[model samples]
Target: MTRVKQQKPAASPAPAPSIPAIPKPDVPARLAALPGLPIGELKAEWRRLFATEPPPYNRRFLESRLAYRIQELAYGGLRPETIARLDALGEQFDGRNITFRRIRHEQRPIAGTRLIREYQGVEHVVTVTRDGYEWQGRPYRSLSAIARAITGTRWNGWTFFGIRPRSGA
Candidate 1:
């Protein structure tokens, strides 16, 4: 007959250190007044927050950006690495030196042009309109949105529809 000894149970883990909480900032009052603000006041507010000349954007653009800046200051901005990656991606698509204004002003396809792609046995069609793209008689902000609707997943509309070549093709 063999005798067995009882083993001791393992010890419990130490308590984790508590992290300090970051206090949220109050919402800027300017955000509420944005809709009615004139372009000059918006520009001045942009200068006050950013400490630089405001980009030559319209009133609505200035208001939205200033609102974002206020929130960004209260919270924090994207990490440096994230911003770097975004910059690299923009450079990959366009040149590193390319400005957004140049891209926005670039010519678009003629208003009457149509894009067609067949997926899952259904032919999807999109039309280029003066302001944006249209699909199935509904206006869309981007082809990606229409592609998502068709594929039930996110996709780069231009690449999915063959407007732009596939990565290797």
Candidate 2:
């Protein structure tokens, strides 16, 4: 009688490596003291954390940036690819640098800037102010309202005034 040897089963594939968890840092309460800090003190705090001179901006701007920097130091900032993509997007938009916060707000024409449009063979001019747009010597809330007044229908002011590119463009 021939005795057969038992064959071992094939080895299974190795398991994937698990990612490690990141530890949270103990942030100082001073990070939250934005509103009350004086302008000079806020800039000093920014210099201490960033090791660079702060921009010449208002107190609220300085505080918000300092808070963001503090958090970025604790957590990771944007990836290089994401930043590159954003830079490309900024260039696409008339080669202007775009910040993350700027995306949250609508683009505004500078004060004293004028926007002209023609609707139904009539000329219309709107002047941008520090607070809002002025049309026909009347202060209005938004460009859309101005556009609606001009077209007698719903319209986006920026699009109507060529501030934004046309659709499909």
Candidate 3:
């Protein structure tokens, strides 16, 4: 009988260390829980989600930002086109300059809004238009002009109409 050298069976390769699959985050639940989380917990969550330190903002700000971040991570962020459009719009208002001058959209009422103000004993109605303001069927370039025509005196139109003061007052 020829002694055939039989090679021992090759040792089986060690199985890869079993890695526990990370669970998908439940976005809605996380968002809902943000409001109730304590400040320290909220900061912890912010750090975990953003991988950075939380901004030194108010509780409401942190909660709102974290909620947005949670949803963004789960469902993906804004589309590129949307982001570009937002940047373009912001540039229009920001002027892309160091001395930033923001156009106060909130202070200006929407076009077609009828501003009714009583001057002395008479009521005056000014209609906001796309180009400017329409007062008594006449188009005025500036609210101050309209205010002057209404009261025969110089006045800050926004203040006169009870709109919030300008950025620098």
Candidate 4:
């Protein structure tokens, strides 16, 4: 029998190295605080929308229901200047209490007439349109539409419907 030569173990290749994955912080939380639509884009869109669509509503143009009721009374014709002033009151009072009044002419019946004014117990002259709902002869959709024209913001509809108070009011 021939003598067997001692066999040496071959060096094993180094085990493959392992890599660790890095942890990442959550991103959605930070973005959540921002408005979904960018401010610039919203303004641009609003301008475009209003420029193309005719204004269907304007508080300055809408004759309140009370005003329309008062206009039906005797001696209802109003001067142009008075009409202009009353229209601007929406912007000033942010829609104050509206009222209707009867002015009976005890002495001069020709000059005396009923008056309808926004806010309680005011003598302001507010003329109502035939349908009693037009702004600058154009149909108005809501008091909020008028508010949008004046304030450049989306106002809640409840206020115009006379069902709810303004957000802060």
- lDDT of each residue in 1-169, candidate 1, tens digit only: 9989888898888765432222454555646777777788888777777767899877778878987877776688899999999988877765553332232324445677898888989898899886668999999867778999999999987678776432432
TM-score on alpha carbons, each prediction = 0.41, 0.43, 0.47, 0.18
Clash count, candidate 1 = 0
Error of 3 at 75 (Å): 0.2
By lDDT, the best candidate is 3
The better-scoring model by lDDT among 2 and 4 is: 2
Better of 3 and 4 by TM-score: 3
Worst 10 residues of 4 by lDDT: 100-109
Model 3 ranges with Cα > 4 A deviation: 1-25, 97-169
Q: How many clashes (backbone N, Cα, C below 3 Å) per candidate?
A: 0, 0, 0, 5
Model 4 scores a C-alpha lDDT of 0.37
List, residue by residue over 1-169, the lDDT tens digit for candidate 2. 9999899998998765432322345445657577788888898777777767889888878888887777776676799999999978767764453331342234566678899998899999999876678999999868888999998899867788888633442
Please write out the lDDT profile of model 4 over residues 87-125, one tens digit for every residue.
776435434423111111121112222223333332333
Candidate 4: regions farther than 4 A off:
1-132, 160-169
Q: In TM-score terms, which candidate is top?
A: 3
For candidate 4, the per-residue lDDT at 18 reads 35
Residue 53 deviation, candidate 1, in Å? 3.4
- Candidate 2 C-alpha error for residue 103, in Å: 11
- Model 4 quality (TM-score): 0.18
